[model samples]
Target: MSNFINKLWGSKSKASKTVTFGDSSFVNAPGGRIWTFISIATLILLWVLSSIFEWVKPIYWPPIQDVWSQFLVISSEGFRNSTLLEHVAASVGRVLAGFLLGCLIGIPLGFALALSKTMNRIFDPIVEFLRPMPPLALIPLVILWLGIGESAKIFLLFLASVWILALAARSGAMSTNLSKVHAAYTLNASKRQILFHVILPNALPEIFTGMRVAIGVCWGTVVAAELVAAESGLGMMVMVASKFLSTDIVVLGVILISLIAYVIDIFMRYLERRFVPWRGKAKH
Candidate 1:
């Protein structure tokens, strides 16, 4: 995970370090693949056994089939006056709206902060003040100010995701190679030319890294945002189900959210690999 993160942010150290990770040939070996399958199978087998033996009450941890049946049932009969798809759509829509809005504004602001001392001095304290405050903590104020509408939820999620992205963008810009900047100056390149051609290229990796982090942070706030007030969302579904002691549905909601977050993260990583394949390495 650490290696993956280092790769994502292009963690260029002061010295040119040649670090070799474990070879793919070894990791992809038949033996390694067998262990990987075995690990996953073992967990599934344990879950089946526990469910069969009633190690825990069915109410708390239902059998795999029960969850599956519940999923099918929800698909057909709907949950809390809405279909499963509707619930998912509600949650996904809110997250995307909030996340995209944050990115649209936060990314450029972060770069500006890193590039301009005046901008940094003006906004740094304000961002810092809010960064450490949990989005949930602001829920009451948001409700009072924005009301308990969709805007409140989106705002909370925006706050949840924005700070990390801003910080990442700033770090990436600051990490621009000083020697390269000086060389550009020697070549009589204007500040705007150097920023567009040199700094942005180096900072792209970190900007994307922050985006990845921001997505996770936004996801973390999904349930909290919905819990405050939501008509239809996976979070709302989970909350409503829990009211009837339906742990299966709650767990199912959790699994679905995890799956969605995982899928998005994978896509983000693919984008990073495509755009900045030369991560955490010095330029030739």
Candidate 2:
């Protein structure tokens, strides 16, 4: 089993690092670093100039100082009787809960469809039928069935994530190299052993990839759900601010959502590195 495991991991003495924006080489590259700095600086310079000179109406593009002031007020005085932290927590909580639940069900279902012809035949049509449908379109139906509550919000997020994850898992499992399986069989490995030791490891990279995508989808779905109706959450805060024509607050909400998503994706990539180090290392 140890030998097989080593072989499965390509028998490397050390795992090669996956390329990411934060990777040392990428960050340390003088040309790339300089270009990135210039790009961001130029954009910020333009924003400041536009705001200072009133190139755009303040209603359309509030000054950066105004956005900062709003943030300070909300952080201390709170928004809609809920603290800013509470609003962030509410949205983050719903996203994680729904995404984790989808993972619990979707990954296994994907494996079943990939590994068993009977399972594929039975479930494929249903999956195909639902996969292309938009999560936004289901809001009314979900409200009818579950009402405009936390359950309804979570359900929408779950729907947004599940199908994407299922497809990722199925693609990963099906992409496994047949030669490795045949070799395992020749070595008298039990079916259970081959399935776990061989297939699961091979599919993990794809599963992680799917997870990244699903989380983004869940984030988008949660905001839309909250917009439809919610007492507290980032989306609700944004909706309320927009209604009042508070452009600064609206911009702050958008920036917060984008930053949160970016951080989560970075964390996911870190996990992928730790668990599936051989990912992107395999020779085609």
Candidate 3:
């Protein structure tokens, strides 16, 4: 018994799998960085040239400077009675609220399903059925059920994101090493001990992956959800601007959302690295 525990606990897995990106390892390579910078700069230059030359009508695609000027103007003044920063904050708040809600409900439900075959058998079919439904499709139902309020928007985002996290967590739990579980059982480890020590840590990597995917989904869904009826948030701003043919503001709102999502994704990645540093280093 002692020998088994020692071997199980002290085992170290050190096989490092090499990860490459297609034909070129562009993740952090210097050449890749240079090429990326050049590509983006070239794009900007082309945009500026097209705008200057009037290649396309200004009404359809405003000049880069016009968009930049609009951004600065809105940053200093306000947009639609609310400041740019306020719109950004409102969008962020809704997304976080929805994402957290989904995570809270989804993760536990997933773990439960993984731990109990009865739960899995009962709920798996339902989950699979609902998982593919688009959040946009639920907008009308949510509005009818909850009204066109923040709750409706939050619910829509929650619907968009919950299934992803739940499935990822379930997959992680299902993929746990059967041999290790049997060994733990043979050692007479309590259910609680096994759950905390063996199950959760092994599942952290998958949970993080789910979180990344869920957040992106939530962000995208919230934008569309806000379009239903919102006075604030970037999506609302885009919709309102489109009605008035304020293409520059619409473009600005899109850029802002994209930038915020990118930053949030980076933060999530950092958290994943910090919390699950042993993701690929686990000893089987």
Candidate 4:
């Protein structure tokens, strides 16, 4: 037993050496960075060339410079009377409220369904029935029930986000390897210990992925919700801009949404990395 323990604990002299700094790894690390920059540079060049030759009309595809100036104008005073920040704040607030509500309900319900067969049997049918209905399809009902106020917007965003998150949680819980659970049992871990220390940690990566996807869906749905009943939001800005044929404002609105979604995705990814250090570095 001592010999076996020593062999397991001792480091072998023939073990592979770790790579040091100033090696080939550094060269490989920068390849992805260079490729990303190149892609952006190529797109900018194409945009400039297209604008110079009038390859597309300004109405349909405005020049980059015009879009930049229009973005500044919108940022300063905005379309109609509302400023860009006000529109952004309103949209973000709605999404946050709805997303928080969905998370509060979805995460616990997901765990319940994943853990308890009885609970799963009870809720699965209802979830399946409602999951197929698009949030936009429920706009009229939501307005009628919630009175075309913030409640309607929140409900729509919640509807958009909850199903995706619930499905993700269910899948993650189901995918946890049985062997790990068995090992936990062999070690005499309690149900709570198995859940918190084993299942939840393993499920976190999938949960974050779901949240990233949910954020994108929420952004898209919030715009739609705002388009229907909002007085001031990025979606409302685009709708109003369309009536006046202010393509620049519309473009700015689209860009702003993209930026916000991108930022949220980045934050979620950072959280994933922080919590799931075993996941290693992300590719991009």
- Report the lDDT tens digits of candidate 4 across residue range 1-284: 76554444443347545764645434323223545667889988998998899899888977888889987887897666777888899999999888888877777777777889999999999888988899998898888888878889989999998988888888778777888899999999999999998888777777777888888899998878886668889888888777888787778788899999889877887787678876534352
lDDT of 1 by residue, 1-284 (tens): 87655544444557644654653423212222445567889988998998888798878787877888889988888898888889889999999998998887787788888999999999999989888998888888999999999999999999888888888888989998799999999998999999988988888998898888899888888999997779899988888888998888988888889889989998998898788877755654
Among residues 3 or more apart in sequence or in different chains, the pairs in candidate 2 whose N, CA or C atoms overlap within 3 Å are none
lDDT comparing candidate 2 with the true structure: 0.87
Runs with alpha carbons beyond 4 Å of true place in candidate 4: 1-31, 186-188, 280-284
Candidate lDDT scores, in order, read 0.85, 0.87, 0.84, 0.81
Q: Please, what is the TM-score per model?
A: 0.85, 0.86, 0.85, 0.83
Cα lDDT tens digits for candidate 2, 1-284: 87665543434446656654566443212233445567879988998998888898989989888988989999999999988899999999999998998998899889889999999999999999999999889889999999888999888888999998999999888988999889999999998998898888899999999999999988877778786579889988998999999999999998998889989998998898889988777996
Error of 1 at 248 (Å): 0.4
lDDT, candidate 2, residue 256?
91
Residue 80 error for model 1, in Å? 1.3
Model 3 over residues 234-258: C-alpha lDDT tens digits? 9898889888998888888888888
C-alpha displacement of 133 in model 4, angstroms?
Answer: 1.1
lDDT of 1 at 54: 79
Please give the RMSD to the true structure for each candidate, in Å: 7.0, 8.5, 9.4, 9.7
lDDT for 223 in candidate 4 is: 74
Query: Between the candidate structures 1 and 4, which one is better when assessed by TM-score?
Result: 1
Candidate 4 vs. true structure, TM-score:
0.83
